[model samples]
Target: MNDILIQNTTAFFEKSFGSVPQKVVLSPGRINIIGEHIDYNDGYVLPAAIDKIICFAFEKNDSKKSKIIAIDLNEEFEIDLTQEVKLSKVVWTNYIRGVIKQLQDNGFSFEGFNCVFSSNIPVGSGLSSSAALECGMIYGIKELFNLDIQKLDISLLGQKAEHWVGINCGIMDQFSSVHGLENKVIKLDCNTLEYEYHNADFKDYSLILMDSNVKHSLFTSEYNTRRIECEEGLAIIKAEFPEIKSFRDCSEEQVLNLKNKMSEKVFSRVHFVVKEINRVVKACEALDQGNIEVLGQLLFETHYGLSQEYEVSCEELDMLVNTAKDDDAIIGSRLMGGGFGGCTINLIKKGHENDIKSKFSNLYLDTFGIELKFYDVKISNGTTLL
Candidate 1:
């Protein structure tokens, strides 16, 4: 543990519970390089954990009451295990409340716990900060109570918790937080929960995340509507070809054969899903063959699809990707999150890190009148006890 975080958390716990925590857990946020909005379609995704993470210091309390203090946010939230809390509000307590409800629903015995939560990850930046917090909570509770559940099981449970909290998200966020490996990207099969890690070697390059500073409050509603469109597309395709399981199970020819049956809007949605899946496959091959240039071009093409076909890219994201493309040292850049506004994940030459940062920052400010936040990240290990 970092000495400052431990010392502050110790003081807070001592003041609140009269004792220090018995265990601490860390869960990291993840960034997807290319594939987006495909997790629910049972498609492929390449994601890895970054250095930014959420940390929790916790102890089992003797009294049957749960108290949580967010050290960084300087807010306190408490809930009693005996009482049921409704989930309509967007308060900070919703996250903890969701976990408690899901655990109770799963028939797990609950007792009082005192926890101090803090994170270095930025909220609403499309970096999976919410999932990191939930993953850390689940890990801390399991370890503190000697629960032997598998990590993937924990992920599913976490997903249910998020669903109850009113955020209709897919499994990608929680899955990455629980299973991310160091120096590698996990290719997730959203349907089977089966995954394979590919060693992505960029000897001369670095991964940079550029925050657009625009919040995605409408992301939830937009996400659900897009998912429904995808299901509609699937419904049309399945009516003709019952053997096709998901968009993942369909081919270009299969989709083209049923083109007339799909509404134009539904067709556009399916077009992106099918092509994004193929992009993920080809991107994986490019990484395997040590062809960073090919992977870079795939990222560019993916951004264009997102900006046009998926209709998720915003002005800030488009500006960032376009600025990145103008630079010769930058290999690739694309929006990293669900929709309207978030960070752009970029692959750039390591030696030009400062140059890339300065150029993008200046361009973003001149164009959008907003400063850009950049993170030079590496693939790091996932959740663990600290």
Candidate 2:
């Protein structure tokens, strides 16, 4: 366990329950070093669970009330066992509520429990903090209640909770939260939900996350719009290519043939989706061969397409990506998450960590006048009760 996580876990149980809990649960935040906006396309994504995670302390309560406290957010919520309340505001509490609702929907018997959640995962960094929190809660409840839930089942349950809470996210976040392994990236097929676990062992290399600090307000709205455009594009392609199951099934030639049917804007969106699908395939090949150069180049290409074609990247994202473009020590850099803001994932030489951080920090400060936070992340295990 990480030091901060250990400290937080120890303190959470001591403060909340006045004693050490029977168990602790950990669910990690994920970094999609590549494959942004491709999860919904039914394409492959390379995501790893970082050491940063949400740690929870819990114990079953005698009463039929589930009590949850968010130490970091300074919020507490309670729900009666007999009824579920849907709140108008979407706060940290809804995440817990969603989990309860999902379990109830599945006909699982659950009683009230006291859970205290604390995490070092930076919220709104596109690191899947929400998923981490949800998964942690699920793990804690499962352990405290002695519920026999499989990891995959728990992951799907968490996804349902997110959907219930108004964010129509794909299964990637939840999948990674549950299935993540140390020093590995999950290559998930969003359509079939079939996934293969692979190692991203860039020897003498590390992944650096550069937080742009430019909060993405349009993530919710634009995310839905992008999905709609992809569906529309799918319809256009399906008219000719009836065999096409998803954007992943269509080739560049097929998209070009139906290019006339879509607007330039839609076409651009389709273009990024098509190329991103191909990139994921190639990235897997690169991962197997351990070619950091090829992987880095693909990351740059993805950011470019996301910026110019998909139009999701903002100036800060663009500047951060371009700043790392020419550096030899850096192989790949791309904006992660729903775009507009968040961090760019960079594959850097392990020895050049300070150099890259110093260089990027100065570059970002001079250009955008905003300081960037660099998270030196390591691939870590996913959700588990301790």
lDDT of the candidates, in the order given: 0.85, 0.86
What's the lDDT for residue 370 in model 2?
Answer: 92
Instruction: List TM-score per model, in order.
Output: 0.96, 0.97
Clashing pairs in 1: none
lDDT of 1 by residue, 1-386 (tens): 34466567667777877877799888899989768999988999988887788878899987778888998888887778888767746467787788888878888776888899778788888999988988888888888888776899788888888888887888999999999888899899888888999997876788888999997566778889898999999999888889988898898788888778888888888988999999999999998998998999999999998889888888889988998898999999888888689898888987899988888889889988998998777788898988
TM-score for candidate 2, please give it. Answer: 0.97
Best by TM-score: 2
Q: In model 1, what is the error at residue 68, expressed in angstroms?
A: 0.3
> Which tens-of-lDDT digit does each residue in 185-243 have in candidate 2?
89888888888988779787788899998886888899889989888888888888889
Model 1: what TM-score?
0.96
Best by lDDT: 2
